[model samples]
Target chain A: MEEVWVTGAGMTRIGRRSEPLPELMAEAALAALAMAGLERPEAIVVAAMNPEEFVGDGNFASNVASHMGFADVPTLRVETATSSGAAAFYTGFAEVASGLCSTVLVVGGEKMTHIATPRVSELIGRSIDPYERSYGATMPALAALITRALMARHGVGEREIAAVAVKNHAHAARNPLAHFPTPVSMDEVMASRMVSDPLRLLHCCPISDGAAAVVLSDTRGPVRVAGVGQGTDTLALRHRHDLTSFRATQTAARAAFTMAGFGPARVDFAELHDAFAPFELIALEDIGLVPPGKSGTITLDGETALDGRLPINPSGGLKARGHPLAATGLAQIVECVWQLVGRAEGRQLNARVALAHSIGGLATNNWVTLLEASR
Target chain B: MIPTTVAGIGEIVSYTTLHSAPEGFRSPLHIALVQLQGGARFVCHGAQTRRVRIGSLVAIEAVDNIYYFSSLNALDRARLFWGRAGRAGDRVNAMTRSVVRRLFKGGESGPN
Candidate 1:
């Protein structure tokens, strides 16, 4: 199999926009094509979690392809809840690596702001089991529960959780495309209204509209997808043995690192699924970058910041970059490629290898991709 | 929307406690996966519990006009299961009957 390299990546500013979903997706795709120096791609894969819910449109991949002027190209859609982008990207990579297509375009987008906040919650809540929905258990509720468990089990304080948000927002302030670019102090995060007990409003990622696109080619280049791993667990959290840790994330990250022939220590930077502030800590430990229960300590010690030894979430992460569900994973990958190529403006780090972590439906489906700059 | 009573109680499959909530929700909520007595499963959220052991018979209670099987209500155990059919009408009836028959025939002896 030929090596797959990300030749180009682009994304629109993640926030509420009057523009339609197809337009946003087209903008991102065109930007990626421009970056790749290609007029069109051989194939396209679109990832959209719920265009029906977000934009009242089905056949989203074809619709997006049409808008991008790739109507006749082989097109397909990939959906795995929030990790749909990463899943689609993986599919495109396989297509190119297996000689099916020399170049493939993978794009993800969502228009979540089209609906009311309550309806958005209801739609997102459907990701959980129906029985859980009947009990008013939504994604945020699950994250809150996990945060509580992590705090109690690992002795992670509220301040440490706030620090995660503060750091991500501070980094996002430098990102022009960030949804919430204003840097907030730890006190502000702590004082923010409580969404759930321990989890404040600032701890959770915002609901935004955005799209991201990446061009993958068989041609070797500065960055190659060294490894990719995908794993899934029961959607119902109750079936799992633990709440504080993401079993699927651990399995996926381990597989990815093994496939990449490297460990977490070799990664100069990482983009983890920080849908919730506490999740960063949980994911850090699950991904084997930090020892169990030590993520909170590392954050408190400023070890995951931009200037830290292992910079994490330099694109502000889902916390500040805005999590448009399916678009989030691809957005993370875009940031990784930028950092790897030293194109990330303010948050660039001295890193050759980067990792992108995405969680689908409260870690029910997890994907981890490792990218390295070719020597 | 529908009025349902606590009929039979089952074991606790798993549970988690939330110290914080997401954007719009406030207060800590505890979510649990409870296997009802008749093979029906449900995910419930409620007040925190210090001890949530498996096999504890919990009572279904109503809060905020929502009916949920809450933590163990020791005092209502006898009344909760009394006069309540094993299955929620018929669909679950066949499933539960077959499950019980298989359990006994399979050499698994226990109170139904």
Candidate 2:
């Protein structure tokens, strides 16, 4: 396998926006192109979760490339629900690793703010299993179910869950491009309206329109791709061996760390997918950043803060960073790159190795990626 | 993978009260994953009981081709007088009434 480097990282401000998908993607792509100082990419890989549902368009990869003014470059699109962005990273990595293309541009974005909340909820619910769909299981509802189980098993409570929101909000307060940057108190999070049982509005991430892009080249930059791995499980949570643990994420993290020849204990930082507040702690455990069922109180202890030991989600994560579905994975990668390059600005942390993890359908498909500072 | 169904008793491992039920579905819905007596597990739309706790015994009740977990004890005990049979009897009575109404309407064909 050939080595691949993250040469450039760019993204538009993550929040509700009115621009079209192609335009948003083009903005991020041009930023990456300029940062990389390249005239053109050898190839392009676009990632989108559901453009057809969002904008009634199907050929999104070509549309994005056309908007980027690329003249007849080989391009393709990858979609694995929420994990599309990470999958696109792997796709570009493969293109370069297999000696097919030297420099590949990977861009992922989504336009979801304009859609109504209920419609958005309904559409997002489509990614779950059909059997589960029959029971009308939305993502947050399923997450709430998992939370109830975890709370019972681990003696966790709403106070610990609310602490996650408070901590991420504090991190987002210092991030210029974060969607929500105000510090939230645990009281506020608990008092917020309930979106699902045990999960308040503050506990959930806001729908946003955003795009993020990265340039993967054969040349090494400040940060290089260390390892990547993926895993899958049954779509329905009922089929999983345990509801409190995500086997897909655990498996992916193991594979990625094994390939990188290091364990989570050695990782300096992580950008985990925390679409819901409790998920921050849950994913920390799932990726082996912490031992099983032990992250409940660790979150309350301020260990995952920006300057704390093994700071997680310094970019505010999905909770405060805004969740654009497809763009989230790439945005996480962009944050890792920025941190590795000493460019995270207000949220900078002294780090050499960073990890990013994402999930597709309710723990059905998951990906783990590792990035290390080139020494 | 091979498919199998568990109609016997099971235990509720985890559960949630769904507030935002999908369109066309009723809200405040009760859903749980039950580990069947034989070790197989599946999701069950459960009866809206006063309280749902982990490790509660439930019986598989079928209605309109849908399976649901009905609490074996109405008051949190493994008593022989399980409430599931009463619900099943109620469902049977409702079906009987519907069938009688259809018969009184001169055998008009309709979905059961």
Candidate 3:
């Protein structure tokens, strides 16, 4: 198999935007193409969690490619719920590695701010199992369940969970493209109204509208896609063996590490999926970035900050960076690429190897991606 | 395909009180994952979580094809009877029947 490399990366500011979904996707795709110094790609891969409901559009691959001035390009769409962007990247990577396409354009985005908050919640809630949803289990509700279990099993305090948001918000303060660029105080986070018991509004990501894209090719580039792994679990949470940690994340990380031929020790920094604050700590442990039950301690010790011993979510993560559904998975990869190429500006960190983790549909589908700077 | 059924009694494994619910659901929704006597587990909606605790026994009642969980102890049932006036007797009767069915399903072994 041919090696895959990330040739270019680009993303729009993640927050409430007026631009339509296709326009946001085109902006990111065109910027990535310009950065790669290419006029077009051999194929295009598009990702949108639910444009059918969010933006009232379908046949998204063709729709996006046409809007981006790549009307004749071969294209397809990929969806794994919230991680649709990362799944698109995985598809593009496979296309390049298998010699099916010399160059692939991967773009993802979502526009949900135009809709009512409750309506958006209902659409996103469709990803949950029917049985669970029948009982009114929304995303935050399920996350709160997991957070409570983690707290009970690992002795992780609510303060530690809130700290994840604080650190990410601090990181976002330096990220011009972040949805919430203002750093929030711990007290503010603690006092934020609870969306679910034990999980405040501050602990959850906002409903943002944005897009991100990347250019992948078989040829040499500054950043190599060293490994890509995907893992999935049962849709119902009750079927899982443990609630504290996501088995899908652990499985994806193991596959990614094995493919890269390097363990977590070699990772200089990471962009973790922090859709909910506590998930950062849970993912840190699941990815083996820190020992089991130790992520909270390390995080509170300032070890997961931008300038910490092992910076996590230098892009502010889905927490402060704004999780724009399908846009988030690709945005995380874009952040990794920028950090590796020394273009992250204020939030940049000295790093050669990076990891990006994404969770889809309550961790029913998850992905792990490894990148290395060739320099 | 044969449809499987779940026991009407279980212990609360994990639960949450949601203040921001979906479009059709009411806010402050109390949802819980309950593991039944036969190890079959499922989610249940309920009125309140004030008396509910992890590992506490709950009786599951089906209303309009939707399942809800309530504390099954006698005192809790008595409190429910006294808490409301109209339809109090019907509610108590339903709760007692559910409790009896759960006990029979367990065959004296009770929830773990």
Candidate 4:
């Protein structure tokens, strides 16, 4: 089996931008191509959540290829809702590891800031069950529903959930490209407008427009794709057997750890989805990064801080860093790559192993990627 | 999947109130996941009720393809009826559903 490595990573500022979808994606693609020092990749794996609805573009792979001067190269798009970028990484990694493609360019982008916030919420709601969407269950509404479940079931408190936003913002303050970099205080986080009960505005990630890219090859480098796994579950939250635990994340994390020949205890750092601050806690528990019902409370003790023992979401996470839909998953990998190679300037930490996890559609589909600094 | 039936009373697994309802729905719509007496859990509309606490005994009454819940023992209080709570509900946009179906899939899902 061929070992996969991340040779280069590129990301654009996450916010409302005037650039078209193709142009935004092209910028990231070129940056990654140059960084990887490759003229032509064996294949291209592009990802976007709702280009057709948001930007009125559908043939994303072909347009991105043409814009990047790789029109004739083989290309395809991956869509797994919000986790599209992570799924693309999974696909690109397999292409390289299978030896079918020695080099693969994985790019993901989303231009969401241009649309009205409510419209964007509707677009995001499209990812929910139609039955539930009819009830006006936006991402935050659904997240609030789950957050309520965690609070009721595991004794999670609102203060602990507020702590997630506070800590992530403190970390984002150092990330130059983060959209909401200002470190907000716990009082501010708690006082913010309540979008959904128990989930204030501060706990939610901004709707961002941006792109991120990563180049994968079958050559040894500082960042090796030790393992990647994907998991799927029932789309509707009600259909699932459990509300607090995302079976998808658990399944994906288990597969990733098994493939890497390690366990959660070995992970030095992590970049899990924090689109909703409370989700960070749930994801940590589901991925086995922490024991059940502990991710939330331990967070108050500086356990998951940038300088803490686990350092989950050192890149500001989706809460403060901004979630650009498909770009979020790939950006997570980019952050890991930077951290592994000692280039994460402001939030840099000494670590050889990093984990990136992404969730799509209320934890319906999930991906877990393990990156190592070396063999 | 085997077919099963759920009783009217159960406990609240989790709940949420949506203040920003879409075009077809009214704001401040309350929704919840309820565990039926028979062990089958599902989400339903919470109506005519203020402050539906978790782990409380809730009664359900079905109407118009939507089910509503009340934390009170409505069964005992005789408060259990298809009472009107106005437009605030998971009121399906018939037009939107068809259009969404055409735009995405025959019968598509929200979270991918």
User: Please, what is the whole-model Cα lDDT of each candidate in the order they appear?
Assistant: 0.81, 0.83, 0.89, 0.83
Model 2's interface RMSD? 11.7
lDDT of 4 by residue, B1-47 (tens): 22133335656777887767666777777878776644566677776
* lDDT tens digits, residue span A4-49, model 1: 9999999999999889999998988888888888798999999999
TM-scores of all models?
0.83, 0.90, 0.90, 0.90
* lDDT score at residue A57, model 3, on the 0-100 scale: 94
Better of 3 and 4 by DockQ: 3
CAPRI category for model 3: acceptable
Better of 1 and 2 by DockQ: 2
TM-score of chain B of 3: 0.60
Off by over 4 Å in 1: B1-42, B45-112
Q: Write the per-residue lDDT of candidate 4 for residues A20-106, one digit (tens) a residue.
A: 988888888888878788888989999999899999988989989999889889999999999999999999998998899999999
Model 3, position A122: C-alpha lDDT score = 90
* Per-model DockQ against the true two-chain complex: 0.14, 0.23, 0.33, 0.23
- In candidate 1, the second chain superimposes onto the true chain B with a TM-score of 0.53
What is the alpha-carbon lDDT for the whole of candidate 4?
0.83
Q: Give the clash count for model 1.
A: 8
Q: Which stretches of candidate 4 lie over 4 Å from their true place?
A: B1-7, B48-51, B73-112
Which regions of candidate 3 fall more than 4 Å away from where they truly are?
A: B1-8, B72-112
lDDT of 3 by residue, A1-375 (tens): 899999999999999999989999999998898889889999999999999999999998899988988899999999999999989999999999999999999999999999999899999999999988877889999999888777765448888998999999999999999999999999999999989998999999999999999999888999999889998999999898678889889999999999999999999999999999999999999999998879988999999898899999999899999999999999999999999999999988999999999999999999999999999
In model 3, state the lDDT of residue A29: 90
Least well predicted 10-residue stretch by lDDT in candidate 3 chain B? B1-10
Give the DockQ (C-alpha) for candidate 3: 0.33
